[model samples]
Target chain A: MLAESLALSAVLFVIGVVGVLIRRNAIIIFMCVELMLNAVNLTFVAFSRVYGATGQVFVVFVMTVAAAEAAVGLAIIIAIFRHRQTVNLQNINLMKG
Target chain B: MQPYYSLYYTFPFYLFGVIAIASALAFVTRKSPVTAALWLVNTMFSLSVLFVLLDAQFIGVMQVLVYAGAIMVVFLFVIMLLNLGHPSEIADQRGRWPTLVAAAIGILMIAEIMVIARGKVASRFQVPPDFAAEQMQQYGAIGTVARPLFNEYLLAFELTSVLLLVAIAGAVVLGRRKDTRAG
Candidate 1:
């Protein structure tokens, strides 16, 4: 069961990664990042089942960090959209310099 | 009989795993950011079920409340705020090369796990007898996590709050109207 949960988490993580790599939209990329984080959280909880409550404790902290990331990330996206008038990555070349 | 019982028991876990993976797939393939966010929320709900199945009740609830509730709402709000409904509906994919590379990478990862954890998939679903149940009985659901959060990890917990505060301030600063800024 542990291995299965880990496997599922791995698959989900891979999907998030593919999403991030292929998707052009900034918000979708952030959502994929969140999916990756959630996959890690699942892995932690699965291990917690075998090891102890420490895994659960770590899951809480992961949630905290994810929330913080969301707040800051979405704000960055909003700001970029305001400046560039679009959220498509190909159009934004300010960082190319 | 033993194998069937294990399969029966692990059925719900697999069900949820399929739901999560499918929703995640949907989330990435959609054209509209709004629909994608909604699908991501579905993925979150299914994962929450998996968390509960794994016995982390508190984390499970937090998964729904924090990820699905607060974060997704914020995502949709940003999408709507920017009027990203129709005009900004760009292509999900860039081109053929990136898609091929992504597929290769994903296959490599899943294959890595399979090779490393070979022959163990048959006996994989159950938690070690009572690791979490014992803790749940002693500290209750939330308290099991709360004790660690308050004691050994207290400093980290406090720092997360500080991090959230900083994020909030940063968001406010960045989200302020450009017209109002003199610079």
Candidate 2:
């Protein structure tokens, strides 16, 4: 039973990874990253259930970090879009230097 | 008997697995960012259900509340503000052999790790008689998690608040529109 949960999380994480690598749109890529974070959250919860309270504590902290990451990441995306007028990501190479 | 055991647990796992996979497929195939965002929300909700089945009720609720509720609202706001429909021209992804190869190799490495881990877990799966009942009692409610989360992890909680504050400030700073007015 628990193993099945782990399998589902793993499969979802893999799919998120494929989305991040294969997609060209910056917004979609970031959404995939968020999916990966949610996958990790699922794993943390499963392990917590398997072991004890410690895993749940980690899940809480992870949720906090995920929220923070979303705020900062989206802000950066918006700024980049404002500057370049597109979120293609490949077009923005100003940081390559 | 085997079917009963499978039905008892594996059914929910399979159900959520299907939801997660279908939403992911929709997310990837959809051209509109808003459409993809909606599918992503569905995916998050299904993942939360899997968490509940795992007995992580606190995290499960947080998954729905924070990711599906709060964070998704922000994602949708950005998608709407951008007004991005579909790309006017399909971005050329051809001739990116190296990147594709790298991704395939990375995936293979992860698969290998999972296979190894599965072996380890299978070897350790000697069932104690009361294990199932005890697990049910342990995860049947969230009170067990609340006590320690507020106690031993108190400092971490404070730090998270600080992190959120900084994120808010950073988002405002970055997202504020720059005016072209002369000084």
lDDT of each: 0.87, 0.77
Which tens-of-lDDT digit does each residue in B1-183 have in candidate 1? 122237656899999999999999998898888888999999999999999888788999999999999989999999889888773467657799999998898899888866875655346565566657687889887888888889999898888888989989998988888889996
State, as a TM-score between 0 and 1, how close model 1 is to the true structure.
Answer: 0.90
Instruction: Report how far residue A28 has shifted in candidate 1, in Å.
Output: 0.6
Give the clash count for each candidate. 3, 0
Q: lDDT per residue, candidate 2, B16-124, as tens digits?
A: 8799879977886677787888999999888888877776667778888999999989988987788776555535232477458647964785696479558744546
Work out candidate 1's RMSD over C-alphas.
3.6
Model 1 per-residue lDDT at A46: 87
Docking class of 2: medium
Tell me the deviation in Å of residue B156 in model 1. Answer: 0.7
Best by TM-score: 1
lDDT string for model 2 (A29-83, tens) is 8888988887777777766655665777787788788889989999999999999
Give per-residue CA lDDT, model 1, range A16-93, as digits (tens): 999998988888899999999999999999888766788998888888888888988888888898898988998989
Model 1 DockQ, alpha carbons vs. true complex: 0.73
